[model samples]
Target chain A: MRLEKCWFCSSTVYPGHGIQFVRNDAKIFRFCRSKCHKNFKMKRNPRKVKWTKAFRRLHGKDMTQDSTFEFERKRNRPERYDRNVTMETLKAIKKIDKIRVAREARHHKMRMKGKKGIEQKAAERELEQGISLVKAPLALREESSLTLSKIKVKVSQPQAEYQMEE
Target chain B: MAAFVASKWSKVGPPLLDNLRSSRLLEPFGKFQDIASPGWNGLLFQQLRTFIQMRTKLKVVDNSGAKWVRCIQALKGRKGARLGDTIIASVQEAQPRGKVKKGEVVYGVVVRAAMQRGRCDGSEIRFDDNAVVLVNKQGEPIGTRIFGPVPHELRRKKHLKILTLAEHIA
Candidate 1:
């Protein structure tokens, strides 16, 4: 059975699942679920919607260009089936899957490499700007040295606290 | 002047004679009229591939109360009806309080056919079920709302009202 990709989310739509729409122009659009179909009916652009694969790909949030994806493409020309070839292909699928998973993890890590530093910097800036919210400005000046050290501790503390809250 | 006339005749006469011979050959089969008609050549091939024959049960895809309709006749040709073709049908089942009643004969337009139809873009489309939208003699759809996807072929068939009322145009 051939698996189709959802037009909106880019999720796999297996046979006997999802809805297929063939436009008057004969462009086939397969939706993974009613949610995708509804979004399409509303004329929402997949690239503009943040949840869609097109959005993630367009915004560089997901891997758009990758050789691993080439294997999953539809091949109209049929390959001559042989017992040995089929057996080899079955074995290769597992190896390919492992490689693809590792590559995806690496891609995700690369995308998120500087995210922690950027988030920390933004938090620090916000804390500096909103320092008066936590402590009065007049009192901060009197205890500036003590508060600076306390603030540093508080910055690290909040992150741990946030994780605990989650 | 005779030589010029002969040259002119030489250019057109053989083709006209060939056309006459072909028409005469096809006349016994009763398809010559369809072949000779302007703009019918395209539809002639389509008619051969059409699947909705007389008595074919089609799902009514409009809110007009018809649930199922049995085709009584194909409006366009004798063979069968394809996508975007008009057909005369009798409502087999319908909503009791709906606009139309059971056994009511109505004019309808084929919106989606179970048979695969090829498009200009080299793609083929086939729907899960054969469907039709109830229309009046004026070719205006009886239903204000169309429930499912309608093909673009309807637009070419001049069924713009049905297209506008459709939920989706696939």
Candidate 2:
């Protein structure tokens, strides 16, 4: 079975669903639903319908310009379906997603490094106010770098530091 | 249910018409006066959104000969639509021999909204029910003749072409 992309929405049209409109010039236009079919029959412009993906892409809303989307390459036939190749492609996509997730976690930690300093300052101020605060489990660990840093902070502030703060 | 009033009042249509009444008094400082000298009086605005806010399967008064229209979009936030707002509606009941076919979505502009709308002069005007006029993207009314009295506000917004085709403006 072959899948076709809808002319208006550019979504995949399954075998039993969607409509096909044949123009006077023998060109066929496929629509994914009755909504798209009706809009096309009414001669409505795709650009004016803000809900359609075509409108989103035309207006440049987070849509990337893929190489296959090039006007000249549009007519190029898709490669024939191969079961083995499809399986390999699926595995490759999953591997890429795993790598992407790990990279994003690293980037998040890097972004939060500066924010942590600000948070620690607030936590230290609260500690000076005699407020009983529960430290995070990671901070409670004796050998953790965060706990070592906290001890260093306590040692730096002496009786003279308390006098200066008031 | 229809109730007949005593014929002592001057005969126009009746003492109580449901809608589409004409009140022609201009109040002080350019505000439109509601009917006040009353045994039974008329209303100025014939349509408003609060009365019949745009909803699916709601009846539409089409002067263009389509018997029914189904509103698809009420535009701004869907809480309700107001006068001069654009809407998308589908023709539900159309004659087989009419200009528009059934299931065709047409652009409609709110000619009258039920909510009281404030004018530039700090005065407000409201209509009896929510009403829309089918128009093209160029803002031209598709109907040859508007069914009832049109408001001057439609013309004030530069829709003079609709005013030219209208039989009366109130």
Candidate 3:
């Protein structure tokens, strides 16, 4: 039997436990428990929930970026750790943590700076709105004047290969 | 001390009535499946890949190519869409003066796909052809008639009326 990670919590999911949802695209999502499945059904983001591992990783709580946690880092110094050297290290760490606190506050503001795109900002824009471009003032929307905003035009790169002048 | 403590209880205000953070409509779709991750399982059919791109022309399978559709957007920014995705499309070819006319932009939900979709239960699902059902601006199917199989996801989205009209549900 193969082991899978729970889609919501990022925990190990053994077979015979947890429910799975296969989207129409055939992408499978396996959840470890009813709580995770219910959270998925209710449209909850695992990255937003404080309890999940996704939240830890997404918000940089992954211990990799938690500079304060460096005090308990796995790396060992090659030389002997003397009392004075250790004390100096501790003092430097204390000062670093103080700086990190201020840096984190600045990062928090920067992370919240950007806005979502206009289309996704509203949930039911398509359902509530009509096609304004199609129903133009003129019949058949005169080809030259038609502003097809949604349709993307194919841009050919002519400059990629150039002919040498004789 | 007892008189002073009793007076403080009256000074406190009652709890607020309305809950401020209960908005659910901000999300475009619930149960979104991420197909852009490192490796997306297996091959998504090539025809289905081009079936719903910008300026893609689709023949109404049930109608035998009589009606044509040109896809605009896949509703999500993923650039391409798969089965059960709703697309904004314009009717390029339809019966003259019919219920749906040429040049009318409408919402079409993909009911079938040539792409093989896999289930969580280790089973694979594939359809023979690509198909769609036109829906109104309200996300409900326009006509009372549906030609072919529809997905259970659509029914779960409260498009039960469309299922009642469809021949089958996959």
Candidate 4:
């Protein structure tokens, strides 16, 4: 079972251990244990409860909402968490990376546009050096971008050469 | 209280310059969700009353005992909107458009998930004493809070470390 962070307290939660309360409205609340659960139950005033029911009644379950709910429920459920989630999350995270990359690319392109060839060459060199020092993973471990099996072959190449010499 | 609870339209106060002639032709309808105050309950109840009144097509929707309706009403028009046609239409017209401006509003992903499950987004902003408020990729806001204060032990840890998954594992 995958460990989950308590939605309420950020405590670690193990499967089969926490209290599961499905809001009378179908929303699931998982607690790490009884303490957080007790507090959660105790904190409920008439106002919060009415707000919850009203909101649920307002937004009837539909596909987009269901998927989002599933993503979260699956996020906590280890069985549904796999490469799919990782890929989706990575794709989403890539939006941030793309923004930075595009900014630099545009800035560099602008700097080179009006420069003379010789000065542009020097500028390009400076830019390359600057980029080299950025320490981005894509720049640092370019070779490791290969598949795991390819990485295994690369790792074993020196041993193979040594064995052939022997 | 007005700064936080008042809608942007309310802050701008009725338009001084009506570029769009539609404003001149159409009678400026009073905003549907206009009574929000700093008090959490008052804002929620008024909005819910509007939602029910609009949903039922009745001009007046009474709030008998449901206090949560206040927050619920503000929640009516998002994604899978649930309130009646009249309220939903008013909410749509009243909703601020495009991306967030002003100070960013931050919220937690779990809370986001909870709200999405219930089909609402703005509710998470109300009582987040513990959630971290940060900026996200959209340059939009993000915030999260555990339901309570940070435990003393967590105060010394790093950002992600402070948020433990131990309680959510099940």
Instruction: For candidate 3, give the lDDT.
Output: 0.59
Q: Which stretches of candidate 2 lie over 4 Å from their true place?
A: A1-166, B1-62, B76-78
Candidate 1 on B31-150: residue-level lDDT in tens?
455545333343334323358989899999899999999999998866798878899999999998999999999999989886766655444556656889999999998989988788
User: In candidate 1, which residue pairs clash?
Assistant: A22-B170, A23-B170, A24-B152, A24-B170
Q: lDDT tens digits, residues B1-170, model 2?
A: 01121121112221111111222112123566796652112223322236324554433444665666777777665565555666788888877776667888887766654465654443344444455677777878777766544556776668887767755554
| lDDT by residue (tens digit), candidate 3, B1-170 | 33343233222211100011123233435568877752223233223334456876655533322377888878864756666777888888887646788888888877776654444554334455566778877877776676755666666557776777777666
Full-model lDDT, candidate 1:
0.74
Model 1 over residues A89-138: C-alpha lDDT tens digits? Answer: 89989999998889888889999999987876666444433434545545
**Candidate 1, DockQ to 2 decimals?**
0.02
What is the C-alpha local distance difference test score of each model?
A: 0.74, 0.55, 0.59, 0.33
Tens-digit lDDT track of model 4 for B58-162? 111111111111111222344332211111111111113322222222211111111112112111111111112122433222222222222222223233422
Candidate 1, residue B23: how far the Cα is off, in Å:
94
- Model 2, B46: alpha-carbon shift in Å? 17
- Kindly report which residue pairs in candidate 3 clash with one another: none
- Chain B TM-score in each of the candidates: 0.68, 0.58, 0.61, 0.15
Per model, state how many residue pairs clash.
4, 7, 0, 30
lDDT of 1 at B35: 47
Going through the candidates in order, their DockQ values are 0.02, 0.00, 0.01, 0.01
TM-scores for every predicted model:
0.48, 0.33, 0.35, 0.17
